[model samples]
Target chain A: MNAPLPAAVDWPLAVHQALSRLGFGVIGYVPDAGHKRLIELCHGDARLRTVVLSTEEEGIGLATGAWLGGAKTALLMQSSGVGNIVNALGVVRECRIPLLLVVTMRGEYGEFNPWQVPMGQATPEVLRAMGVLVQRADTADEVAVQVDAAARIAFGGYAAAAVLISQRVIGIKSFQEQAAQ
Target chain B: MSALRRREVVRALLVNRGDLLVVAGLGSTAWDCAATGDHPLTFPMWGGMGCAAVTGLGLALAQPARRVLVVTGDGEMLMGLGSLATIGVQRPANLSVVVIDNERYGETGMQKTHTAHGVDLAAMARAAGFASAVLVREASAIESLRQAVHHGAGPHFAQVKVVAEKEAITLPPREGTLLKNRFREALLGASASLQ
Candidate 1:
């Protein structure tokens, strides 16, 4: 078990550290602002290989392939992206591939975009419906902890698992946020 | 004179394949691979329609030293078309994607795929920046295809044009987990678990 993290923690860094320590070779993503820091951390570290996917579903396939080839992998995506992997997740469930997903929420808690609601609201149940074990981390302190646990369970049990980092933790994206930058 | 037979093309590709790891796409390609005498190194997709190429990409990325081949159908390839862009970017030299383009969805009542009309998958692969991409319409070219798959510096893509027809069912083990476990064991030996 990993030692308890400090109260004042950079959750992204914490999650990155946990994954690195667990020996994940590949990090697949569709690029999400919520996971920006963690993605950068994995990319910067030589220990991990970063694959920027065209869509979220590719990450699951990537993870499955990497695992079958004897290397561990994880995926990073936004909550709405979860809907994209609904059918593809079958490969993991049927094959018993160990997949760890770190998703940033979009629809709930100070949400600005109406389009994100349907899929984002359906994320957890959708994942559960696909036979994936779901874990939620609504706060920074819980983020790394959930990731660590989820990854352990996924790999250790050879099952599909996900850690959903609440949008409250990722912070809602305002329309003007990027325009100002 | 005509498109190739998928089973024959798959058999030609697998002849004395040695240690090459294959990620067989769902439906006919999986059945085609199984038809060639199932091997522990081959993971035939029971589901996940468009995942074949990226799965091969993942395997290629993971096992850099081992040659990885993805054999999928035209429809499966078309569905995961974006993966060509993704693969083109990473460009794992050991990976090769072979599309069995009969230009029809064989399992789904032989509906015409985009290739049956005008879409050129090989051209799409070329545009995606694959190191080597071609459309193979002759069995005579398969010797070269085998060579490229077995011994080329490639993030290669080959669309072997096959005559779309119903093939006899050659089922591999239906249990997905066993297929995965045996493949990992064959590749990683005892270390499959530790990693």
Candidate 2:
């Protein structure tokens, strides 16, 4: 007898739900295709305040302010945006402010954009160098667990933590796919 | 209208401040805030240049009942111009951003900034959708600015034009950890370290 295929997991929805469960009242983000569902979910939720950022660095400031005001907050961004936020991360790390970053990875596993590779490969190390605890989720099933753990460590411990969602889970966009579109 | 004195302007703004959390940008603005009086609620950044306004936004969002003010310089405000738009959309009523437009980068030896080239920060803030955005060129207009900072329904933005001149530096506590802890203690009291 043939076994049934496992159910397809919706990682974005799962992550969004996890953030809500974790008591994040504010979500600051720069738009990315990988985060479409999560962004939509946040926008529709009346309890959550969604902020669209022009640069990733602004999200850091927004999250910092939100925390200071006694609200739990999260920042959502793509890996490429990580480069823009290194300096701002100092405020979070040095001040011992709790922060949750959900980053969608690019330039790995059949990536078409060469520009994204350097930052994508360097993201974890960069965050680590800045004193952020880094966690990874390669499969859809791991999304909720990793995000939940990161949220706990960040808010409960008053420290910075990041959950990097791999490109494989987000479905890598190849050059051919872009050309076809 | 002649440019107002920054030190006096800052002092005036904070004269009646009560339970207000302040996030000061680096250099001159930080010094101005320190000169007024150091309080546990004051968080003065030593190096984070463009993060002050957003930092105030976070503090305001975290404590909706308390007012959060961000006092920053022109160069710093230009560096973080995008923050206005973010604040515009979020519209945190308790948050206010006051940009001290000396029109120069005072820390870097008085180099001219974009504001000197006629950049209108208040207009930018207005365009970005702040509930109230004003330019305070005259000292006579300060009372309205004060009202906006303290009791106005906002995300308010104000660009206070001041003469580009050096003043005695009044540095606040330098240790980031100490500042953070004190702020947390002042806000959360005994439960600050509970987490």
Candidate 3:
């Protein structure tokens, strides 16, 4: 049956549900077509405020600011962008600020770009090496639950937590439909 | 330096339970994820230069009572050379910087760095007015870390020779806005508390 039509999954809705229950205030993200739907959900949700950034490292500065501002924040970036936030990891560790890192993975499954390979391979290793907790979801079915768990681990433990969303769960890049047209 | 030597130094320093340690660039390349506590905030935001010590300086300034330790790479240290003088002038007693020199940019495909020439980083720190500085090759990390942290004297700088590890591990894509929000939250929260 057309490979299950990719399940029309509500991954972002799940993310919203988890964040709401966890009381994570605002979310800062870089726009990625893979995350557009979730971005829209975060925009519509009253419990969270969304700030968009041009670069991943900007999210680091922003999140640090948010924490200083008395709001819990979450960073949503794709696999390649995490490379841009390595400095933030250094800053955060030094600042001793606790937050959540929600990473939507790219470059692993049927990746088209040669550039994505390096960051994709380094994501988990880098996170682990820095002592940031890492979690991965292989399918849309697991996104929200794992995100909730990661949130608890982050806030309750006061340490950085990461959630990795795989390409199979993210499915094909549908934004291509606009470019194709 | 062998992984064992690096670990020896890290373990020695980490024993000072409540202190904050920030590692920049590939200095964290082989770090043990489970080695942190409830308060450690590790920044791996960008794979670039000069950011580790700058961030460490900020933390030292913001939290004067908390000891802040930065593990930086030689390549990264070269990028932000000006911070040496800045740290000296600020004279934050809680700050200590340790540069791990592998003589190369171990992260981006093993390119050579200024450390290959054996530039005297400790002398540079001294010239910049740091109260204490030293250079220790591979076998001496354990003693150096112990001495640096124990002195509790002032802004301390040390260079540790390390052997580069050749391996590539992928990182997740950029979450630009999210990371900014998280950092902003931290800054704002701290400021709010002061008010």
Model 3 residue B19 lDDT score: 39
Candidate 3 lDDT over A93-176, as tens digits, reads 655556788888776776656577788889998887776899998878788888989888876665688999887676554346
Q: Which candidate is the best by DockQ?
A: 1
**Per-prediction tally of clashes:** 0, 8, 83
Error of 1 at B163 (Å): 1.1
Candidate 1, residue A8: lDDT = 64
lDDT of 2 by residue, A11-92 (tens): 7788888888878888989988778889999999988988889899988887776766667889899999988999989988
Q: List the residue pairs that clash in candidate 2.
A: A65-B58, A65-B59, A66-B58, A69-B59, A69-B62, A69-B63, A70-B62, A71-B62
For model 1, how does the per-residue alpha-carbon lDDT over B49-118 read when each residue is reduced to its tens digit? 8999999999999999999999999999999999999999999999999999999998889999999997
- Runs of candidate 1 with Cα error greater than 4 angstroms are A1-7, A178-181, B193-195
Segments of candidate 3 deviating more than 4 angstroms: A1-5, A173-181, B1-195
Q: Candidate 2 lDDT (Cα, whole model)?
A: 0.86
TM-score: the better of candidates 1 and 2 = 1
Q: Candidate 2 chain A, which ten residues in sequence have the lowest lDDT sum? A: A1-10
Model 1, residue A87: what's the lDDT?
96
DockQ for the candidate 1 complex?
0.79
Mark the 10 consecutive residues where model 1 chain A has the least summed lDDT: A1-10
- Per-residue lDDT of A1-181 in model 1, one digit per residue for the tens? 1112234679988998999899999999988887888888988999888999998888888988999888889999998899999999998998889999999988888677889888889999999999999999977888999999999999989888999988777665577773442
Each prediction's TM-score versus the true structure: 0.96, 0.94, 0.49
Query: CA shift at B3, candidate 1, in angstroms?
Result: 3.7
